[model samples]
Target: MARFLTLLVLLLAIDRAFACKPEQHFNANFSDTADQLSGTEAGNLATWVKSLQNDYSNHDLFVISSYVKNASQPGDSAERRTKWLKDFLVAAGEDENSIVSAGTQVYKPENFFYTKITPSTLIIEFVPGCPNPCCLGANPVKEK
Candidate 1:
């Protein structure tokens, strides 16, 4: 019995040692010309950001706004969307330091990885200190 207990302890320790942070992803979709985040979406993102701040260390939050590939717009709507997302993050108690970057990207079908491209989708990626092990390197590839 003692030997079995020792093995269990060792196994638990090993599991903890090899454990990696879970990937945190949040997304919000909007229309082509939309520049604001919905109340529910903003609230949910704020809650998630707060949780991540409490649970992890040396993590970063990235807000990437995806715009339609070939849409005609009078102004840079992507910038507006990014600003809205960052503002929501701030409202959720996230400081400016926690935000790694708020950028814009064009959505193409071929660039689909962990996210799906829509007219206007804001992707919030919470990256840990060591992102190499996140998703066990299965983010862009199928898990085998």
Candidate 2:
């Protein structure tokens, strides 16, 4: 019975480590040239950050930005937007080390028939992993 219980616990831990969490999609459009986040957007982000802290504290947060290529924009605009998002997440109390920006991806239409163009977007994903302090190279055993 003890052996069976130990196996069950091991299986549960393995399942959790491999579990896939849903990725969140949000519009990355800023209202002005300054790339400022509006009050509503800021409020929503803060709430999301709090949820991450409360529910997925053991997971690593990954942020990815996608944008449609435009001739008028600078080439590095997408990367800049991605960095901005990471900065915002860090500012909202998320551990900067736990947050990883996958950088920007250029959006490609599946075919010529897709006429609707979408604005830039941010994708947020959380994956199970070592939480901060432990993940930051600090010895967990010594911290206690």
Candidate 3:
């Protein structure tokens, strides 16, 4: 019984060690224009990216942009916003290959229970390792 308990504990620890929990670093609303990040927002983003590059140099960065169809203009797209952010980060000195991005469309119901719709938002995450063991050598970035 003691040996079984020890084995169970070891298994749990191993699972936790390899778990792919991404740390959210940024979240905010972006304008319709891809490069329309405000001065303050741009400053903050640059600082965070620099810090990530300097402090956590070994980890990869994941960025996600989510937008509601009804909240954005007819021509706006989540992919454009996400790509803009990735470009901005690269220009700011972050390695282009170390960053991954995803754009997602969010659906919201119009019912009274969910009246408030979220605006177009960008989220940045820090990914430490591949989420699955099978893809250990390949660091594929998927939406979190």
Candidate 4:
């Protein structure tokens, strides 16, 4: 009986480590507000999160719902998340040409803010500037 129990525990550990398989999706969801996220530990990949927001904002088309497994760990900040997502989506079958990256400042004032992405956070406010849609650059930087 003791030997059998030990074998069972070993099997369980192995199963947890190798539980994930191809074609098996583990779904996750995030709230509409991503500036300050409040969700499960299974946070979403950056692209998926953005897709959800874009869809809500009527900016993106729901062409394909690609299945992508979670990374071993969630990214620490938006920049990290974006980079991780670009690589993750490509690995999960997204066309390289179809992918683009953009980020909005957390809270800063500037016409062309965030030239560097070393900082991990993503919720800075924009600096006061000329009030013009074309002049204000709210687009996130791409890494392709």
lDDT tens readout by residue for model 3, 21-66:
5464676457645545777878888877776555443555565656
Best by lDDT: 1
State the lDDT of candidate 4 residue by residue for 1-144, as single tens digits.
Answer: 999999999998677547622111212222322423344422554455444333332222112121112344233444444454446555644445544544423322342274532222332111212222222246522211
> What TM-score, over all chains together, does every model reach?
0.59, 0.56, 0.62, 0.25
| Candidate 1, 52-113: lDDT as tens digits | 76666546555454455664543377777777777777776666676654555556766676
6: Cα error in model 1, Å? 20
- lDDT measured at residue 114 in model 2 versus the true structure, 0 to 100: 53
Better of 2 and 3 by TM-score: 3
Strongest candidate by TM-score: 3
Order the candidate numbers by lDDT, best to worst.
1, 3, 2, 4
Q: Please state the error at residue 120 of candidate 3 in Å.
A: 2.0
In candidate 1 the C-alpha lDDT for residue 128 amounts to 56
Error of 1 at 34 (Å): 1.9
Better candidate by TM-score, 1 or 2: 1
Q: Candidate 3, which ten residues in sequence have the lowest lDDT sum?
A: 109-118
* lDDT at 124, model 4: 19
Q: After best superposition, candidate 4 residue 66: deviation in angstroms?
A: 21
